[model samples]
Target: MSRYPDVYKSWQSNPEAFWAEAAKAVDWFKPADRVFDASQGAYGRWFAGATCNAAHNCLDRHVAAGRGQQPAIIYDSPVTGTKRALTYAELLDEVEIFAAGLASLGVSKGDRVVIYMPMVPEVAIAMLATARLGAIHSVVFGGFAANELAVRLNDAKPKVIVSASCGVEPKAIIKYKPLLDSAIAMAAHKPEHCIILQRPMERAALIDGRDLDWSALVDDMRAQGAKAACVPVAATDPLYILYTSGSTGQPKGVVRDTGGYMVALMWTMKNLYGVEPGEVFWSASDVGWVVGHSYIIYGPLLHGNTTIIYEGKPVGTPDAGAFWRVLSEYKVASFFTAPTALRAIKKEDPTGSLISNYDLSHLRTLFLAGERADPDTVTWAEHALGIPVIDHWWQTETGWAITGNPIGLGALPVKPGSSTVPMPGYDIHILSDEGHPVPQRTLGNIVVKLPLPPGCLPALWNADERFGPSYTDEFPGFYKTADAGFRNEDGYLFIMGRTDDIINVAGHRLSTGAMEEVLASHKDVAECAVIGAADALKGELPMGFVVLKAGVTREHADIEREIVALVRERIGPVAAFKTVRVVARLPKTRSGKVLRGTMKKIADGIEYQVPPTIDDPAILAEIETVLSNRPVVG
Candidate 1:
């Protein structure tokens, strides 16, 4: 039986009333008069008449409920061998002091502040403090290059910038202040003030007049008896601007509103994660990304749950047992991570010995996102952990998960490669290139009906002109997702890959995900990525990059031949899978998304610029060397 069987009907009957009731879940100072306002075309407004503060709902309200001594954030950094937990009272004190410090620096409401800090407790503190003052925050990934940081600074034109001295890695230390200085020099618009969080591991040169010490400012504010108070603002006010890579090489800032984001994420905590107040919830992601902002900081905190802020890699900090240790130590009830992290652990410890060594009895459910979860990886995790491996799908534009099993509401049957049915507020459809519905099981564009849900991005920051053409212009009254997939008979949505990832061979479109799925099912293959290489006759031929399991010593040629035959037997000769190259590792971004486009460029002998988001830039050079040594096939 469907737990939320009547959800669609209730939403359809009166969306405004439904969302109005949902909005009451948060601590709003003034109730909303208008539920939704769409008079400004596709740029709609939610809770337009309401006034509230996000930080108040996330911190102060819980403290007022007599939960002041309860744990709010648990900081675990294996790289630095440091662990600390802050209760709600302690967090409020820190946030208030920081908020006062920002006020002393002349940071007022509506001012933009760029946060360039590592994944520590301070990142969350800075974000909440910025929100407390009604200022907008833009967090640049700590791993981003100076040029990338400059681009965001110039675009957002922040009045203040917050950063750490350095970031700690397992092998080396990343000096961040140098990068911040270089970025400030390169940017056209520079901030008036810069605050540096001094890390004990390494130090960088600080500017005299423009820079401020984090501890000095906070202590001064505390001594002066400065109080942090939430400044109420209209619900339609912009909360944060998160930049996402654009096809045109410019990062588009996705602007999320405060009212809608708060309501949506709070609902997600109970409905999607199946977590309640005081439960330990951990989302293994950085604070720089949307997943981190929504799940790690806002969602769990808003629901009064204790959120874990981890500062280390999945396998390297100590071993493959690092994640298990944290889960057991924290007694986490719900856990979320990316599939790429799981694949890395599987490659290192194939027998699941590391997972078996820990006591994970407290773990209730496991969720996967950020990338498509392969069936092999999902099945392995479900069998080894003995929990439901739920794979949900969403984008940076949407602040929360859009499709999943909805474990809190009676988890639906798991389909190996599918993201399952859409949530209540979403009306999803698979459309043809001509903007018409496609038949079931036929690949096409994924789109959502117009008037997107509350949590969806209202518009791009200062790019209102580009918003419509980028999202809705492709299909009238619909938001184009740019992903290619189809719906199954059971109403499950299967995302093959991005629309541009479709390989056209001999006038036929073949999904790389389909071929990769077959390759992953093989016993010898640990992980794989498929890309279309240039071919003179076929236009484009499928090329496979396979990462073999540990301790596999079979000849490369024999394994390649077996993979080719498997594709031919399963997907037929139309696939034209010409070459299979075994490689040590694949290039991935800091968020664990495979750089298939870069791989394709290398395979075709085409010169391409290395993306700044890549985790290890040297991996591309290794891939090029492997491609050059491989024998060509026609």
Candidate 2:
């Protein structure tokens, strides 16, 4: 007796009518005549012949509906010791002023505006303002290097750049101005105007003519009584271009459409997250990432839910209790975060004592994304938090959760290692390398049948040619996810790492995720990652790097032996899981995905390019040090 079984059946029967009904949730200037048009092949147009303003629907409509006094955004920064809440009415005023300010700077419709700022309230304001003017925004991660920033700027060719003077981290004050100046100096296409948000802690130098202070422009607009009206754009208009790391050196800009994106995210708020209007929601992710873009800014506001902008690390910001503290203080109903954050907390506090201190009665559900949540971590969290730990699977390109545990519809039976059934509007199938359907329980490539659900990436910015080839060329009319996984008889999808992550040991393909899950189940292992290292005899051998529990002072040799035995017993001897090295930390991206490719290269003694998006470059050197002392396994 699921509450949404009928809804799912109806959507499957007639997807066009179903999505058309869902699109009505948002305020559209002109309603769409057709729900989906796939005549252009894999690059389909959704909500054709419709007009809408994304920013207006997210802000103004909520105010007009008499929810103006409801909390819209709650900015919580533990590092800066700052907390502020803005209601829908106040948020609209700020957005209007900023939108007007951007217009005054000659930023109009269709212009690209690059935002290189931290996780502050102004970051969301700048994005809303950019959308309000029908300009496309590209937000680069604040922690990205100047060279990385320059590459994005050169690609987007933005007319104006909005950035902050400094970002406050727990241990250091990151002066963003120098980075911005360096990037601007390096880029061939320089922006005409730069708007800088000055933080009082550490101010950076600003060139008088080129740089405009945020307060000066906004205050001037307020004094002059200028109001910026939201501009209506075509349904297929680009809302934002997010650059995701490509296998090659260059990053791919994933373009999201305004009309479809708004409609899809609104549906997700009610269905996936089970969040209602005026409820508090917190997504502990940076605005640079897609999770922050959909959940932190657009999705919640589109549904009139209060979203929390958190600016602090998971473990180091005071203690491991930061997440629990935020939940208790804000009375957050749904909490979304990455598994890496939970692993970090588990490493520091094995007994969950830090979490026990906070009362999280208001926390309705905890959603895990970004990377695969290890079963051990999932079990630990569920036992400790006393709430449903939903592990949903999605990508930056998908915009929202594709396959998730539909707790909002009905709490499905918990499957420890699986990201449950595909939501309505998505037709997911497991296909072999030859693009044929694979049997249940057999590992294969995961693909979505075209046309992809609304809110999916329409095309890569300036790389329309690459979009189809990258996603759909392998399987005609199907979007190859590049992820390796299998769906069970019950339709529960279990993602078993990436297709490239499969290791051929003695001609047998083995999943690194399967091996890592086995190793992580060890009581002493706090976190672990497995990568296939090149072997002369077996083609490739499984190598594991593990981080032990904080208080566990067990000898490395003993722990490694136990983990090797555990893997052997669980995955059998075919896995060749012999080498296990205990490391202090794993090389990971800011989003918490392990650099498995980098680890494989380091272990195989092959030259590798260091990814610029890595959270800590020093961790690579640490892994190299660990590998140098350990002899290669045969």
Candidate 3:
């Protein structure tokens, strides 16, 4: 056995002794029949036979223990220009109202709802409502354009879409209604009803008969005598479907069941983040995406720990000091942010004491993710904030923090830029192509060897539909994390870069699918292709090549500016585009894929074969014509 028995002892040494202790650490509804289901597969079940509702763990258990009055969330709305505090009791009340509203819509068990809104309180409401009704929610990052949104709408076939007029940003306003209209128009199965939340932003007049205002729905629910819809649910039932960027022409919707997600989330929050009751925890991420869905909404709530949701850009209406202002304003106990913000902040105002402006005396920990974290970035935050900057790692498919320097586990021994050992009981390893574990220091593909945490996703939404082809077909048995990295001898995991087409721009992890989704959002755009181009400024900049709707002029930087602003407003300023190239058409494969490789060659100044399947080879000439006029940023 290793010197640290808890650290190195094998499962064979004492199986029950290991997982049983972990299971007890987290709050569960009922005891599980079995902890590990080996007969099923490597990705077997956890907390089997356990009955748990995510909302229950998030509120009831903590509230029952007299922590109801404890802070649950501290919200910031740009319209209000003030921070609003919410206790667990108040949050529960709000969630209850929305849950009942979802019930009012006849959203029941098994129905899937799409939550396509920015980081707002309503986003939380939609998720809890789904969990409360036992309905699965598929949260597409609100940053996506209409065509992308339409594709997902067609795939998931949601019964309803909960959206907002706009999610605030440092940039221009994003009118979501138009996209909703376009997406709804194209979707194979249109939602029976559309629920829209009009932020303080000036939205176009609501579509008559088709859209219902959110405030009106809440009003109707209030007028009626309705109790909280805190419906109980099974652990194994589907909770949410988060789509990952697809390399094979289509996005893969990864489904994570309720019980498994709860187990993993609760464990990570308490252990990985070292969250304590009443301590303020904030993730500077929009609920439109996974970090927001898991940590910002579910994880902290499950723990009854106070969570902070900021509804503006990190550098909103002011300098980068805006983030520090929020940190100081809330006295956040722990803060998690992407490295992209840190890099831009550092690059622009190097050697400045923006960290000093914030009274982070309560700041115990800082976590970084959404991209491969640069070591220097974390070190910078540490020096500036005078706190431990914990660089963690996980993906939308993983659901919650997997490998992290768990601060609450005692004095955390951290290696800057390394995602510390896998959270307890998670068997993580770096393997070469053949599925064999590589030596500790050698770089290789990242894969989870043992049964992953309960927080891990429940395969693609249509598992039988696309399972053997996308995920399992490529790497059998072990769960493949599509990033390239290796574990250090110290057992800390380090992510190098993406093994997929996805690009990490300014710390925001966005797939080319998501980027293309942004470009296609333009009113004058038909289809779009986004590829990563070299940039010393951001390491990689998303260069969007778009096919415009007929009659749109190409010389107009107005469209480029609008698309860039659209991304900024939709996904926060972090995802803003570096270049928006208006191309006549996208290079394609014989099968109609957006010949991304050809785009890559164009980005790299190399000639490549464009398959005979390209719908209009002339579009390539248009792309070349446009590029001849622009300067390529190296």
User: Against the true structure, whose lDDT is highest?
Assistant: 2
How should the candidates be ordered by lDDT, best one leading? 2, 1, 3
Encode model 3's per-residue lDDT on 482-537: one tens digit a residue. 77776776677777555656566766555554455556546665556677766666
The order by descending TM-score is 2, 1, 3
Q: Tell me model 1's lDDT, rounded to 2 decimals.
A: 0.90
Error of 3 at 430 (Å): 2.9
Q: Candidate 1, 267: how far from true, in Å?
A: 1.0
State, as a TM-score between 0 and 1, how close model 1 is to the true structure: 0.98
Model 1: pairs clashing at backbone N, Cα or C within 3 Å: none
User: On residues 287-405, what C-alpha lDDT tens digit does candidate 1 reach at each position?
Assistant: 88999999999999999999999999889889988999999999999999999999988888887888878899999988999888889999989988999899999999988877887
In candidate 3 the C-alpha lDDT for residue 472 amounts to 50
Greater-lDDT candidate between 1 and 3:
1
Q: How would you encode candidate 2's per-residue C-alpha lDDT over 247-267 as one tens digit per residue?
A: 347799999999999999999
- For candidate 1, the 10 contiguous residues with the lowest summed lDDT are 1-10
If scored against the real structure, what TM-score would every candidate get? Answer: 0.98, 0.99, 0.78
Root-mean-square deviation of Cα positions for candidate 1 versus the true structure, in angstroms: 1.2
Q: Which stretches of candidate 2 lie over 4 Å from their true place?
A: none
